[model samples]
Target: MERARFDNLPLEWIRAFEAAARTGSFTAAAQETGVTQSAISQRIDKLEKQLGTHLFLRQARSIALTVEGETWLPHVQTAFESLRQSSEGLFGAARSRLTISASSSIIDLWILPRLARLTEDIGAQLSLRTMVLAAGAAQEDDTIRIRYGAGDWPVAYKVPLYNEMIAPVAAPELLASASDWKELPRIALSGPRPGWNEWSARHGTPTTPLPALRFDTFVSALAAARAGHGVLLASLPLCAGDLAGGKLLRVCEESLSCHQSYWLLASNEAVSRRQWNRLETILKDPVPREGA
Candidate 1:
């Protein structure tokens, strides 16, 4: 008997036939797929027509597999299992424990907010380590590192967290005070991130406000900004949550885009191909959308 070309066969029909065959009930197949029993019946009927063979022996109160169906069942089941394994291996996070290291500020401002979704996407529980400095996250093996740079790491895999954008941002209340944002005391931090001088130069602004308060890290600088002490030239990616949640407000509509970005870097042994693919999908769009 002629058979339908495999490529032409509808996967949904195959799924209906497989589920009905496995459970010995059309009702059960419908329950599994959230469709009506008649829908499953229609699919299998169409499937039989395409294959030119009956797959079930229908009875008054039940059904049994035909000889052809019994012969074809194991092959279909094997194909389903193979598809499952391929999907899980390529897109599902591994069940192994995962270790990740990044700066305290990235962990606090960026990673922490998206972490629940991150873990879910990778399909593993995470062991997080806060890197004390930029150099700290690099000096490790069997750990995935989040680093900010031009993506020059000599690692097996590296993907950017998001494009880094900087601009003046302040507490909503501070901006609402009707104070000149440029005249408000600025908050400064030590990092490779572009600051007031770069902002002034890039956007054709004349004045570069000096910081009245300074800190060595973004966590401190942002805290001061949130408290309404001053405006901060902030990393938009890092403070994305705050801006979305109304904890902070953009001082201007413009953003100073940067050439560098935070990166997820990992050595070969640090992740499976499946896990890495999952990580890329999750981290590339790390920030949650508004009202989400």
Candidate 2:
């Protein structure tokens, strides 16, 4: 009955193994770690050798955890999460910074504009981190996350930022063309959320296929629309500034409510009343009028 030695375990090897297990792919784990796939495989191999167990059942197209790996995964994840929380508590207090995670489009279009007001009100420096929703990024407990989806995330307090509404928008110049605007090339966003098909259904527009220009993010799609490349289906709150500034023009009066909405999600540890109040005030404030 010899006691197990903890000193021999390498943190990096465990990290590599955990990432690979969580993502179910060595390639994905490598991408997350900013390492080569071969390096990830090597690290996992080393970890398995050290532990004397086969952690993964490798297949041609996928990888599955062996029973040992499945049991080990939670412990590894919990360890990492604890480390993150401890580091944030130690370092974040010194900097007096609050970190927030949101999609690039949301940050660029909505949050960035109002950030100064938030900082001014909260008396703390704010750090913005882009959470690429398209990439399946996990939310960290150390930060507040502005995520778009149905409000059902467990272990986090969810606050409705806004009810999602989408409408067609284009540069004013697009209206000059003799062609019907509906027939104009449409910009499409490809992601978890619905796009033109859903918009059409909601607005009673015919579902006939139109010439499309696809972009992976709403930011890019909106940029293309502003450049007069095509009409874009834009989230109302995200585009409020553009519309107000006349950078973009609503193509029609019709707006469609989406099943999904932007939510402010914070883990229990992160959701202090003061911090919540700061965010609530920032979002609840009415957009300033022109020249006001």
Candidate 3:
């Protein structure tokens, strides 16, 4: 059997077929596509002829997909979805919704606090979406992406938000009269940052393992520390509020420069210059420092 050439199939016919399959009626498909019922029937017929297979089993009151049509439906639907997303990316969507995607930890610890100010500054409504950064995940081109890295995203307008500084922090109650803070249970972060081992080496703390509870994100570890569970190695920017309120205190004078920093990234067409500038300004404004 000869395979159909790509150019031989028209997009209009495919649209008609999809609408008919989805709506289950040629009349309804014609209404959706703004064509006559006969026109829709003709297009589906032409599509079936091009594919050398019958797609629909026509009935008195409705239509159902043939075995071949059922097999082909998902592929056709996926292709249409891809095309729609691509169109939205290129021309922008009709809605004024601005989406910002970032890691769950970043959103909770950093962005959420400043989100109201951001919306006020830009005078536009914004939506926040959390994304987990994993290898081989598709990058979202249609929304602003806040990522933690060395600030080298190709073909993107990039701005460094802030470099992270990490320090050992604990609830004030946890540190009460505790002479050897190192011996206390440590809440450890298991993610990308330099964690307990590096902090210990920097602060000259003993390398011996202590009672430890591990969390996949710094946010969770910080929460555990805030609840007086254990000492946490936490980022200063994210926990600045807790430190200032005396909810958490630095265990030692030692701090480590996280080399990795959070960066704001967007395609050139993703956001207007004015919108991007306002968002950057809002994010970069300094928060009240600990004890100040």
**Structural similarity to truth (TM-score) of each candidate:** 0.64, 0.62, 0.64
The full ranking of all candidates by lDDT, starting with the best, is 1, 3, 2
**Measured by TM-score, how close is model 1 to the native structure?**
0.64
How far off is model 3, as Cα RMSD?
11.5
lDDT of 2: 0.79
Query: Any runs in candidate 2 off by more than 4 Å, and if so which?
Result: 1-95, 133-138, 286-292
> Taking the tens digit of each residue's C-alpha lDDT, what string does model 2 give over 69-115?
99989999999988876666455443256788888887887777777
Instruction: Please give the lDDT score at residue 134 for candidate 2.
Output: 55
Better of 2 and 3 by lDDT: 3
The CA root-mean-square deviation of candidate 2, after full C-alpha superposition on the true structure, stands at 12.0
**Between prediction 1 and prediction 2, which has the larger TM-score?**
1
Error of 1 at 109 (Å): 1.9
> Which tens-of-lDDT digit does each residue in 1-292 have in candidate 1?
2433444799999999999999999999999999999999999999998888899999998999999999999999999988875765667555487888888898887777667777667767789988765344336768989988999988868989888888889998888887667767788888898978788888887565677788888998999999999899999878887888899999889888899988999865777768877677766775543222
lDDT of 3: 0.81
Q: Give the runs in model 1 whose Cα sits over 4 Å from its true position.
A: 1-95, 134-138, 206-209, 289-292
lDDT-wise, the better of 1 and 2 is 1
